[model samples]
Target: MNNTLTNGLGLLSLVANTGRAHGVTELANMAELPKSHVHRLLQSLVEARYLEKDHQSRYSISVGALRLGRELLRNIPVRRMALPEMMQLVGEVKAALSLAAPFGHEAISIAHITPDGNLRGSMESLGSVLSAHASASGKLFLAYLPEDEVGEVLAQLDYSGGGPNAHRNAESLKAELPQIRARGYSINNLESGANMNSFAVPIHNQDGKVFAALGASAQANELSLKRIAELAPILLESVQRIESTIKEENP
Candidate 1:
């Protein structure tokens, strides 16, 4: 790529990484570019709708960037192909179901289904992000990843508020991954939230590669580990269905 485009993207990355609005001077300093050059690039991004400038001259990523992200996600076949099976699984299990994928240092929920009931607690939204060390889906992703990669991802997490039962360090978490792999699933027992338990199984793609995680969550009293284990067959069945659908659609 040309320097102009490269520098423009560099500036954009600086702003995005900050996760907040930034002024021209601030961006220039962080990117080590001249203020005038940064201003020109920022204006170009604003005109392209990639970034938006406020009245105070601060800039932040705009809706267009989110639109681009959504467009990319829309091209992924798993979410679309898995929705029906996920919904059916939710009905069979009578709990909240979620489809999540490893995103950056965390797990991002792609789709969610909650059975119609009064027993529902706070459910994770479709786009919600969860700590990889605390949530069942996250743990499943971590379990399947290389240990070094897992350590890199875990290094980015803040464990202070993870929960009472959360793994305190990478060493402790590494010790438990074998059990997860042995069972071909992961469990969360009040690790993410109080009295909340979840179970997750890996969903594979056409190449028989783990692509995403399918999980079910409910109140701890309603779903114990044994109950989750019993439900595992149903969940794995749904995962197989989803995998088949993905292969059919993708191939």
Candidate 2:
């Protein structure tokens, strides 16, 4: 192996985020790596489940990559502390409970509690890439990623259409993000769905940087917007408990 290999970790990261569905050649161009080298590197990354190669030879990152990151906090106390409270809240709110933690440029779901009594939110999978532009947890995590990553996410969010409910006004959402940063919550509607609403609040680290988002989703009918407002305090309180437990264990 060349000691100064051009095919390395940095190139892998580049391929993972260059808008998905890329072949090794295109990835190499973006990564400034050579074709043969990048192709072999991607094969290795794919074997390790850090990347996935489609039947068409297009490549993107795998959920297993996020799973590896999640394992770092396998003992995360917040998840345990929040689970029961999330369960209880889902019962009370008759909605779905969702948690998202930072996964590079995306917020990957670390935990979720679904209501069991014949009620469900649209989301059922544990590892789907919920839209940062349309999903509550996605938008919430978008605000907490790195500065440049946040800019990229926001720019992408711009194309989601200015409709009636979620992020109806681009200027307004931009103005609100600062407020969200100040207050520690991200709330919006994609406005694409007429009968759905979601609310998300950030879970802060001891350093006060947001590392996760606690979210609840429901039909606009079963859980009215006013009801969500009433439920915000309790949802936030659960988040506090979750964070406090994590800090106590780690710090």
> How far off is residue 114 in model 2, in Å?
1.5
Q: TM-scores of all models?
A: 0.80, 0.66
Backbone Cα, N, C clashes tallied per candidate: 0, 4
The residue-by-residue lDDT of candidate 1 on 1-251, one tens digit each, is: 99999999998777766779998888999989899999999999999999999999999988787776678657767887877677666667988888888887678887777766222222237667878888898888888887667777767767765666888877777788889999989999888888889989999878777779988889989889889999988999888888778878779
1-251 in candidate 2: lDDT tens per residue?
Answer: 66334456776667654646788778878877689878888888888888888999988878777766467446665665666667777777677777776665456666766766332223344544555555666666765666665555565554455235666444545556666666566655534366677778888887777777888877767666677778778889888887787788668
lDDT of 2: 0.67
Could you tell me the TM-score of candidate 2? 0.66
Which stretch of 10 consecutive residues in model 1 shows the poorest summed lDDT? 115-124
Q: List the candidate 2 regions with Cα displacement exceeding 4 Å.
A: 1-33, 46-77, 103-106, 117-124, 130-134, 138-157, 161-163, 168-170, 178-184, 190-194
- Each candidate's root-mean-square deviation in Å? 4.0, 5.6
Measure candidate 1: CA RMSD: 4.0
lDDT of each: 0.82, 0.67
Model 1 spans > 4 angstroms off: 1-21, 25-38, 117-124, 147-158
